[model samples]
Every structure is written in structure tokens, then in C-alpha cells.
Target: MSHSIAHQARPGHKRSEDGVLRKLRPLFWNQEGRLRAGYRVIVFFLLWGYGPALVHGVVDRILSLVMAPGGQWSFGIWLDPVRLAVVVGAGWLTAHYIDRRPFSDYGFQFNRDWWLDLVFGMVLGAALMTAIFLVEWAAGWVAVDSVFYSNESSVPFGQALMAPMVLFIVVAVAEELLTRGNHIVNFAEGLHSWGHLPAVFAAWLLSSVIFGLLHIYNPHTTWVSTANLVLTGFFFGLGFVLTGQLALPIGLHFSWNLVQGNVFGFPVSGKVFYATSLVRLEQRGPELWTGGPFGPEAGLLGILAIMVGMLFTAGWVRWRYGDLSVGRVRLSHCENRLQGR
Candidate 1:
């Protein structure tokens, strides 16, 4: 059998036709059975790893909201703390026992490249959010109050900036490690030979969808919220593809959430906050655009914003790394693949 053919073999064994051990490519960067399994593993981890935490968090939030409506949704201050310690420590420990992948393979390495990726992610993430907010205003879906600054939530100058910074750093690192780091890479690598496009697209779609669905478990969720979250997954996935480093996607994810939750004071997706916000907006007008209970991110404006962000990141990636043409999609293949390292 041709090792070049995906599923030509199975896990724990590689079958090569001629003796030229075919190198394994990333599924998201290739087309192979490894791609299929790569996606399955990610969905599994998301369900197993983050699913329980999300569910418990939702239940707790519900109780808290009932007990204290104002401060109920604000547990993220502690919950969202930047735990570089956790990502490195726990991820290292997991690699030691449960998984065979090396710590560095997980995209946990701290280096100059890592920092640059982080910076770009933050700036781009903020820009995307800002762009979405502007669209909302133009649509006349939301009316701003002079008091609220822009109808979104706000905090004092001191806390406003710091809170989001912390949240972004923490959430970005952890989630990226789990989703796009060693985990996704391993899956992709195992499949890359059969056909690269199939594998890559599968990984992208599966991981992204799981990212969105996880949000549905939130205390206050609607179909629109789920739809917005699905788009969010695509946005983050594009970031991951554009900058193979997990750092960039993590940065973007953190910024988007922190801005929505703390800076803007609207529900981040469906999760609301009560902590000292940097700004506050009383949404008055059409529920479709203002996002009503689901928040702006769950609205039409959110869809447009994320789509724009996706395109921008894709373009940047193409510019920096020559386009790796595959069907209608064009991405920087080597840059998007972990093993391309």
C-alpha cells in the first residue's frame, strides 16, 4: 500500500510502500486519515477538557446570578487570570504522563517570535472588535449614550486596561495550547500524506465548531449567540492558520473576550459581567443588532466583524508566507503547519 495514501495505515504504525518513509504532514495542512483523527481528537479534548469546566461555570453563574444579579458574571477576574504557570506547568506534566508529545511541541516555548506573535494578535484582535462596534453604530442598531461613552460597558482608567490585558494573556495561552498546539499538530501530522486539503479543512472546521458550541453551555445562550460563537471559532482558526504559533490565536481570543466582557460591559457572548467595567452601554433599539441578551457579539455586527478579521489575517499570512494553493483556499501551508517547524 502507498504510505502516501491517507488511512493507508493505522495509529501506532506507519506503512510505507517503498522504504522511503513518507514524512507525516499536518492534517490541517494536508489531506489524510490523520486529518480525520486529528479533528476527532480535538473535538474529544474540547468536549472532555473544556466542556466540563464550561458546564460547571455555567451552573455556578446561574446560581450566582440568582443570588446576586449585579456581580454574578464577574468571576472571570480570578477565573481568567493569566496562568502562564498553568499552561507550562500543567501542559508539561501532561506531556510527561498522559501524552507523548514534547513540551516544546505544544507551542509553549517562550522566545522572541512568541512575543511578536502575541503583540500582533492583541493589536489585530482589538482592531477587529473596534471595527465591529463601528458597524453596529452605522447600522443604527444601537444608540450610544454620552454617559455610557458608546453604549457598551466601561471601567475606570486604571482597571479598564489592566483587566483585559491579564484576561487576554491568560485565556489566550491556555486555549491555544489545547486547541492548536501539540494536540492539533499531532493529529494533522499523522494524516498529512493522503491529501493535504481534506485533512486541513476537517481540522479547521471541527476545531472551530467545537470552539463555538462550547459557548452554548453558558447560562444565558440563544441560537444567535451560538451562531456568533461559530463565527468566532472561524476567526480564531484563521489566526491559528495564519500564524502557526498558538500565541497569536490566543492573543486574539483573549482580546476579543476581554474587550467584550470588561471593556465594553456587554455580555461576552452570553456571559455578562458585574465587576468594575471600564465602560458601560445601555443598548436601546433593535434587539437584532444590539444583541439583546446574547450581547453584540451574538448580533449581525459580530458576524461582519469576525469575517473581516478572518480575511485580514488570511491576507497577512499570504503576504508573509507565499500562498500554498489548495482548491479554492489559499494559505501558507508550511507556516500553518506545526511540523513545518
Candidate 2:
């Protein structure tokens, strides 16, 4: 595969006349004159791994000088933005230089169609979460304790509610960019020679596995939770695979976390949000059914929700576009440039 790709005549790539340059080109570059996919992936991971630690170290040192000893900042409020910056910066750099493509090619075009799909995704996510809460309630598995409760007396009510909202929004964008926007696009592009449908499916499945593994170390994580998260990744990627836009996935992700942790007071992926919740509740159902401390994503109900989400996403795509086919996720850089994208 590598040998074939090295020799293929890619559009816009002029073969070097110099013997040394020609010989070296195949080693470091593809037929398109861009860094090969494997090398690009290596550079991306390196930036993602080290950039956060370096930035955090410098920020921590600077904060230590001004703040009192042992004084702390909210993890969600403070550190999340730093992570967002690092992740977005890494993705932009990789797309612009290593991939030799427009950053928006990764399904982030801010057009009317994108925004409409985003709204649909957000509504679907909220509706699904509400269904989960209602189902548990009907089964007598959950008991509500209060509404608009805050665990911290020092924090104002509005601030408590707003913090998690901001956190989830930032989290949604960053995670979707890394997991769906960057990983899937690159994977599909790298595998384009395998054929479009095969490349898209393979890339989707591979990136979803990575997404599940990413949450393996979260608080109270279990095998069941991890497996369910793999399904969740597929659910989130459905819209992207169909429409090739990040808006749907991002909106769905944000609303799902916000409504799960803040609105209904569920432990989101095992991390309990103790600060504030609109409807505090206790679970009395069996752990297997209710997900216990790991939230719904660890339970059967979550799997059901994921299936429903996939169906709804497909329906939306069919309705909006009058066709239900995979988007051009496997379009290569040369192809994109020729189309003037």
C-alpha cells in the first residue's frame, strides 16, 4: 500500500527533476507532496501529548506566585479552557501544515446547514436524556430529593449552574474536534485507497474504539462503561459520517453532558457533579440497570438510547438532504484542492 501510494500521480504534485530530491521525496512525502499519514499522525500525537503538560506547568508556576498557598481554582472553570486552547491549536496546526488541508475540512464549516444540524443534534440529545430520566422514574428506580440545589454554600446559584454549562460546552468542542474531527478525517484519508465505503466504515470504527479507550481511566470506570462509551462514540459519529460536519456531534455532546450532570443530577461517566443540579435524585434501582455510579452510559438503557440516536440521525440526514449516503469523508488532499475547497 505504501509503495503504491508513493508512486501514484497525485494532482498538483510535480515530480522533482533533481535525483536527490526525487529519491528523498518518497521517504518523507506522499505523491501529493504532503507528509505521509503515518508521519502526520506521529506529529499530531506528539503535540497533543506534550503541549498541555508544558503549558500547564508554566501556568501553574505563574499562578503560585500570585495566589495564596493551597488556594485553588475550579478545575472545570480554569483548566478546561487551557486544555481547549491546546487541543484546538494542535488540531489547527496539524490540519494546516501536516495534512495540507483547510481546517474547516474536518467538518467545522459554520454555515446554515451546519447550524441547523447542530440544533437538531442538541434537541435529540436533550430528548434522549429526558427519556432516560423518565423511564427510570416510571420504574421507581429514581427518587427526586430537591430542585435547584447547590452543595456549596459559598458559590452563588447562578455561578454554580453556569460553571458546568461552560465546562460542558468547552468539553464538547474539544473532544469532538479531537475524536471525530481530527481522528476520523485523518484515518479515512489515510485509508482512501481501500475504497470510500470501506475507508469510512473502518475509520469510523477505529476512531470510536480510541474514543472509548480514552475514558477508561475516568472515575469509577468499568468494562461495561467502557464498552458503552464505544457505542456512544458511534452514536456521536453518526451525524459526522453521514453529513461530514462536526456541529451535530458537538451539539449533541454538549447537551448530553449538561443535561445528564446538571439538569438530572446523574453521575456523568462516573464523575459526580456535586456543585449544583436542577433536580437532585437518588437511585434505588439495580446497579446493572441504572449504571450505579457510572451514569447511564454504563447501562443497557444507554445502549438503547444510542441506537435510537443513530436512527434519528439517519432520518434527519435523509429528510434534510433527500438522500442518505456517506459524505465524502475519504476525499484526499489532492482531490480537495482540485475542487477548490
**Candidate number of the best lDDT:** 2
lDDT of 2 by residue, 199-285 (tens): 778888988988899899999998999999988998998889888889899999999998899999999998976558889998998
Q: Would you list the C-alpha lDDT of every candidate in the order shown?
A: 0.60, 0.82
The weakest ten consecutive residues by lDDT in model 1 span 324-333
Q: What stretches of model 2 exceed 4 Å from their correct place?
A: 1-28, 60-75, 335-341
Instruction: Give per-model TM-scores.
Output: 0.66, 0.85
Candidate 1 positional error at 293, Å: 1.9
Q: Considering every candidate listed, which one attains the maximal TM-score?
A: 2
> What lDDT tens digits, residue by residue, belong to model 1 across residues 72-171?
3344444454244544565665554444445665554567866776777778877877666666667664455433232214444554445456655666
